[model samples]
Target: MNTIEKQKLSVLIITLNEELYIKSLLKDLDFADEIIVIDSYSNDKTTAIVESFKNVKLIQNTFEDFTTQRNFALEKASNNWILFIDADEKLSPELKSEIINTINNPNPASAYLVYRTFMFKNTKLRFSGWQTDKIFRLFDKLKCKYTTEKLVHEKLEIKGEIAVLKNKLIHYSYTNFDDYKAKMKRYGMLKAREKFKKGHQPSFIMMLLHPIYTFLYQFIIRLGFLDHTNGIIICYLNAYSVFIRYKELKKITSSRI
Candidate 1:
């Protein structure tokens, strides 16, 4: 069944230095009526590769913030509904089926949340915090907006009810431990900056307890242990990032005080 004939939708992606993953992602998403790729001046072959695709509409936009980039991409798309996907992720076969089904029959829900299956190295870390991670990827273009202030972990602002899509978005997040740590460091800085700007204060208890709780929640209770060593590392690094964020926030707040 040609889902495009029933519901018009655009597959929008905002990318920066994503040459390795873009082609694979685009290959499976041929069902999209339009493909809008907003690139942030990648010195890599991203633009060249995107041009190779017949349907892709590429735009070079400087990366400022996630909200600005995504909103800018939305403006470029002609479709009324949009499916936002990351360059590092691809729609699983099951997810492709779900998307086709959803497009064939528009659900009453305004937005749809899809789970992501995150892979670390050679293993699929199902027990870690990533396993149950769900994000709102499909929504009406006019009804959603990414938060401008909170740049990282930016979520769409939707007014109506959200529905869940059964299949998962395959996320090949970390190539190695170093890659994971590097990302955490970058994300921690952004998160800390956001907290400092908000005038939020972290107590001693929070600074010490939050990371401990996070590690336990993800590794033990969340069954992150099932993934064995990799799971433990993922959970540990994730909690460590939290600790670093609060530590940075505390220092920033203290200096201001």
Candidate 2:
């Protein structure tokens, strides 16, 4: 479908120090009628790269919770149809075409879930829980909004019907193990903070069992071994993240007591 025939779409993105990936993502989003970037005052060239895009409107907001930042971006959207994508993620050509078709057709659903394929260190992981990583990113602003339940792993709340897309969103999450580990640490800390805010008290058993279960569930149950070395590393890293999160939670809870 051509641009004129398709419903107007606003592509919303929240970024913080995403200079390395913002340019490429902006390039891929040229098909959208409007691109709204709500940046958290990235100290790098992220703002500059976003400013270069004519279709994109750059808005700087203080770093807050993910849900708040995303909802703020949604309000700035002129189109009712909103596609919220991360800075590290790019829409595949197939997915882009599918989105256009879906918008043009205007289904009764309020939101669409898109599967994501992760790339780590130049390897596209097909297994190891990554294959099952699908998120509801494309939605109608009037019918959907992000939930404020969790700080790190926030979810979209849809008031109406939902549909799933076939094509995958390409996610270039980490360039190397070091980068991945850094992200895991940050996420772990954020998760711990979220748990603390919810008055969650971590026990020794949870700190021990959660990581073990995480490793076994992903590496064995989820067939992480199928992806070979990368899968193993990812599973181990995920377990480590769980362990760190619980440990941090314990420390925070202890200090409070």
Candidate 3:
């Protein structure tokens, strides 16, 4: 066992009915000094499971945009060093060790980006544009914050230099096809709402070609065909998600006009 130098690190997570993956995620996060979960009133065993952990603190809030929920979590954290992780994500042993070492030895950078390896139905995906998946997860709360521009795919904005970690974060993104479709639909709606609010007008060209282009780019250009059935399904669903978003945007625009 490696004796890591103690560092005050707060692990922050935002959840909404994520009972399936919450327990396992929390278990792997035992190394954190405090685990703060900002839930959107999940009517499931999510809260109960989190309560089982001694170091975890759960706060229930109404469902809002991703940026708002994440920023709220940041304010609730006691420590300066914050690691924002989703319920479906678990820290690999290598990542855990790397995080501990990084925090112990202070760096001039305000945040660190970690790569993620996505799993679909328990199979790790190597292609389909998932190989280069990375996000800024670990950061100093005072120096970094999520941008409010994107309602669905919110990204952290750092004030100073950004460092990259070597190890990958394990992400169990989808259990089955149904789960994947459901999330894509939900995200599409959220993205459409954001665009509508920004006064984006839907064009017939975009509605017609965007989905087709998206499918071809991911499946053919990105080598999504390498994953076989999983790749095809994911690429098709992704294209479907784009179509749904634009369709909803058109509806909203038509109603306004």
- Tens digits of per-residue lDDT, candidate 1, 1-257, equal 64545777899998877888899998878778899899999998999999999889999999866777888998898987789999888777778777767766745477899898887865677777776798889888767777767867887888788899988887898877877788787677678888877878877898899999999999988888998888889898998888888988877877877
Of 1 and 2, the candidate ahead on lDDT is 2
Lowest summed lDDT over 10 consecutive residues: which window, candidate 2?
A: 1-10
- My TM-score estimates for the predictions, one after another, are 0.86, 0.92, 0.94
* Alpha-carbon deviation at 220 in model 1, angstroms: 1.8
Clashes of each: 0, 0, 0
- What tens digits encode model 2's per-residue C-alpha lDDT throughout 1-257? 64555589999999988988999899988689999999999999999999988778999999667777888898899999999999999888888988888887845479998888899867899888988899888888889888877777778888988899989898999787887888887788878988998888998999999999999999988999998888889999898899989999989988888
Measured by TM-score, how close is model 2 to the native structure?
0.92
Q: Of models 2 and 3, which has the larger lDDT? A: 3
Model 2 residue runs over 4 Å out of place are 1-6
Query: Residue by residue across 37-133, what tens digits does model 3's lDDT show?
Result: 9999999899999898878899998877888888888889999999999999988788998998888874446899889998997899888888899
Give the better candidate number (2 or 3) by TM-score. 3
* Candidate-wise lDDT, in order: 0.83, 0.88, 0.88
- Cα RMSD for predicted model 1: 3.2
